[model samples]
Target: MANARNLSTSSEPLNPKTFLSSIFDAAVAAADAKLTIRGHLPQKPKGRTVVVGAGKGAAQMAVAFEKAWDGPIDGLVITRYGYSAPTERIEIVESAHPVPDEAGLMGSRRLLEKVAGLTDDDLVVALICGGGSALLPSPAPGISLADEIAVNQALLASGAPIAAMNTIRKHISTIKGGRLAAVAWPAKVVSLVVSDIPGDNLALVASGPTVPDTGSRADALAAIAAYGMKFPDAVMAHINSRAATAPDPADEKFARNEVYLIASASVSLEAAAADSRRQGIEAVILSDALEGEAREVGSVHAAIAREVATRNRPFTKPVLILSGGETTVTLRAKGKGGRNSEFLLAFAIGIDGLNGINALAADTDGIDGSESNAGAFCDGSTVARMRAVGVDAKAMLAGNNAWTAFKAVGDLFVTGPTGTNVNDLRAILVR
Candidate 1:
């Protein structure tokens, strides 16, 4: 964790919105790949040094690597369409995210070609971040791109855990599950990753494009059946026919590969906690790896906040309860909202009419689920404000219309794009 610093505040009372926002900001600033990659650079190689990357932060990671290294770097990186950064030697290719597209397929093919014929004297630096799976959707030999897209759609709505989803993604993918590292076989590979997966499992992040994978096609099928995910014949055909083809742990190809955890949710949460401490507020970090239904998680947080407020059993008043991790939301209704909105809205309802409680939840990527807003803010009066605006908080949540509910109350938090992804950061302040 970084050093803690006090937040500048006037003599007046605490501003919940501003306080929560500052905490969130500190968390995001800690995960910046451009800053984090400086301490983890590899030595200059004898032959050519190629950089291959993918995810929302891939473009920025490439730019940072280009600036730090003292050699000629030429390679391509795929990122979400709007999440590109300026780079001199490295080429950036914008593609789709949360779902694969034609552009991702073409860029994936090009990336494989760039690292295919590397020599033992060369170096391959893999810049991987959260959204690499959808950004590098190069399907296996017999599977079509359409098949991959179909599976992606199911996985997004399946309400399954991220590990299960990435396992399925890796099995059907040609560029994931250490296949990328295998392609650069004899050449040394170093991966600098901004992890979104809980527990900082590099093998599951972006489906382990440059790391060994222990998951198999059988695991994917089990997840599909467990989640009741339905896909078309083509997708099912690839899933059923494919065996466990991902690179094994003892593969000689990955013997020289190196992986670094550049940034992660746990580190970000601790950073936020430290900031809160320096700001004259007690901070309690519940967990950095909490994962479950979004609304349910919100409700649980509300319960904890209520306990702290009513009794102060675990913590005293004026404390900030923090948690970080990627949460899932099942598509219950055809309403417009994301996981963060659902979380905050559920929290609003649970803490309705209760005073001295406020909270904020947001995805580090600046986008929550498929919605435009990064997240929404909720205080004790949030539900009252929604009721005054003719929005039933519970109904809105059930309909997956938390975005609209929060919009009516003017609490939506939009941060455009942070160019980094470490999953979600949530805070509850009780004063």
Candidate 2:
């Protein structure tokens, strides 16, 4: 990967927004939207092919499936409000994201009703993706959608990782934990997945609606305890009751169920790297499975960039270091900013100056967290800029106010919605 010292800054030209958009476009291209989950569809069934899903990518997947399938197809999908894609046949519903709302709960109920009466001759295509867990929120008996929303908000603010959050969600949800597929018993289930989780664990992605879940209600309670969040007695009782239910049991009904990860973070990263190469920038993807605390990863990347800048070790200059995967932020700040902004802010503090480094951090889905910003950007002079503005970068980092800080410096990248979610992408350009 290129180091900071190797990047040549000139009076020629540079557009931070355009460069970041290019990298994101490459990442999306790598996901291969044309494939979707349709490639895994089984032969035409005697019954109908009902497509049901929930996530940021569900609508897009619906569009892909519509074009690929030649047989009878009808169903509904749920996505975050304003994240909807243009769809002709399948019903696409929008609802609150990151927090389950009345609309999401109703949508989940309708989805369940849609597939409940299917027979062995029918097929159920589940387009699962990131944010589905929140987008398909159906609280179990004794749990209310209001309570679920409260817990979800708390969990998100607690900084629990996506996997842990989904574990809790699966247990609390009536449709998750493979219950959706189980309800469609006798009907063949094909789960087409676009992974947002770091390890691409199908069960954790979208709470494993069609895929079997290895987690249990106990796991959900444990996650709640791990985060020290308070819940109502009814909520606690619901978790206790689910202890009797084994999430993933071997059953004759499940024999026809299958889950496949058709698209992933690595795919997006490789596409970005290829794009960089095409742009005359040598790019190397560090890994597609990178995971950890967001700020810590930022520090590590900054250190590597420093090494390349000062000593040309491990890798020389003029190459872009790229990586994909989900990195989480344990929210300690009341300020606005997503993981991408936090990562960039941390990287900026580490690099400070020494010239010739430019980097971009963004969520492939476009919206970072609940914020409108895709992510944030940093250059060699970022530190100087912060200092000149009389803003204490360290203090902002402490408050988890990287978004506010970046916005103050006009470095936040807001792309609205990119209509995809392959996790996080980082591009470190070393001079």
Candidate 3:
């Protein structure tokens, strides 16, 4: 249990902003590849050691493995553009994220080719994390990169949960949902996963590239229907065609594969909570697997914070409320912001300038949605400050323009690529 006070050795007194930032830093530190990856590393294989992975943290995980392992390793991994870390042995390739691209498709093909004809003695180390589903795109035989992109876009805008999105992704791909692991049949596969999804479902994280998939084509269709998504014809045909089925979990080929959760949102939240307690604040972790719309979740959290502040019904004052999970944002308005920003905006609205309440919400990956900022911060004065500047907070919230609102208030959190992904971390400090 690392103390929050040790996060910064400076002599300055820790204020609300500094304390919140320290809490977030503790969360990110807990999920850092260099800190967590070495502990989960498998023994050096007797035969050829191949490293294949994809995600925002894939490259960093590779670097960590390279530093910890003494054996010679070679392979390739695809990561989001700008999220790539320097690695000497394992090749790193940059590709588009949140949407699949030709680069990702080509990389997935190359990875499959690399694993072909592997003997039972060989080892395949897969570095998996969030954003891998899009970073390692391998469209089905009938689907094109453009078709995959369209379906991803629709799914993202539909506010569908990550599990639902991954179910559909597995059904229309060549390498997802245990298909990657299937290609390396008979070879020992040890996947080191940094989970970003709520519940840490091994099958859902990054679409479970190296684990057994229990979902079926019917599940994909049900998700599409439930979300009212209008996917492209090619995507629909691929799912409806005979090639829709994923690799069966009962297959003996998967008997040698192992999936290890190196880090997760729950661990990160616990780290934050420990630090808050060290700072003499009563920390209450509402939930680490919270899901639903970002705004609604923020509103509910705000209500809880208010109750603690006004009546102390649930807890005493000077309490820090913490949570971790992935929240969705339905694109109702054409605005530039991610779920974290939207959550902060709604929280600000719900608090309504009530004194003695301050909060911070940010994605652990240091990128909130598609925005440049990780997320945003809001205090009791956030609403008042925006109103003083002639900015209507409610109007901005309605337009889904939380980015603009936070930017105007100079509250946008901008920590460039934390080199890790564990989902989102949020904290509300009520005094």
Cα RMSD to the true fold for all candidates: 2.1, 3.3, 2.3
Error of 2 at 117 (Å): 0.7
Candidate 1 displacement at residue 87 in angstroms: 0.7
Model 1 lDDT per residue over 1-431, tens place: 24533333346667789889998899999998778998999988999899999998888888888888877889989998888989899999999888889999999999899999889999999999999999998887677888889889888887898999999888788889999889998999999999999888998888888987788778888999999999777667777883546779688888888999999998899999888888878898999888999999999999999999999968888799999888888888888888889999999988998999989999998988777788989999998898998999999999988999999999998887888899999999998
Model 2 misses residue 125 by how many Å?
0.8
Clash pairs of candidate 3? none
Number of the predicted model whose lDDT against the real structure is largest: 3
Which lDDT tens digits does candidate 2 get at residues 1-431? 35322213444464545665788887876665566555666678888899899899788888888888888899999999998888877999998888888999899999999899888889998888888988998888778888888878887777677888888777777898788988998899988889988878888888888777677767777878987877777777777784425456576777878778888998888778777766666788888878777899899999988998888867877778898887878878687778888888889999997687889999888888778888988987887898789888889888888887888789887777766788998998876
- Per-residue C-alpha lDDT of model 3 across residues 1-431, encoded as one tens digit per residue: 35344322336544888889988998999999899988888877779999999888899999998998889899999899899888999999989988888899899999999898999989999999999999988888888888889988998999999999999999988899998899998899999999999999978888988886788889999989998999988899889987888989889999878889999999999999888878767688888889999999989988998898789869787788999888998888998899999999999998985898889999998899887889999988898899988889889888888999999889999998898999999999887
User: Which consecutive 10 residues in model 2 have the weakest lDDT in total?
Assistant: 1-10
lDDT of each: 0.88, 0.82, 0.89
* Candidate 1 least-lDDT 10 residues: 1-10
| Backbone clashes, candidate 2 | 5
Against the true structure, candidate 3 reaches a TM-score of 0.96
Instruction: Give TM-scores for every candidate, taking all chains together and pairing residue i with residue i.
Output: 0.96, 0.93, 0.96
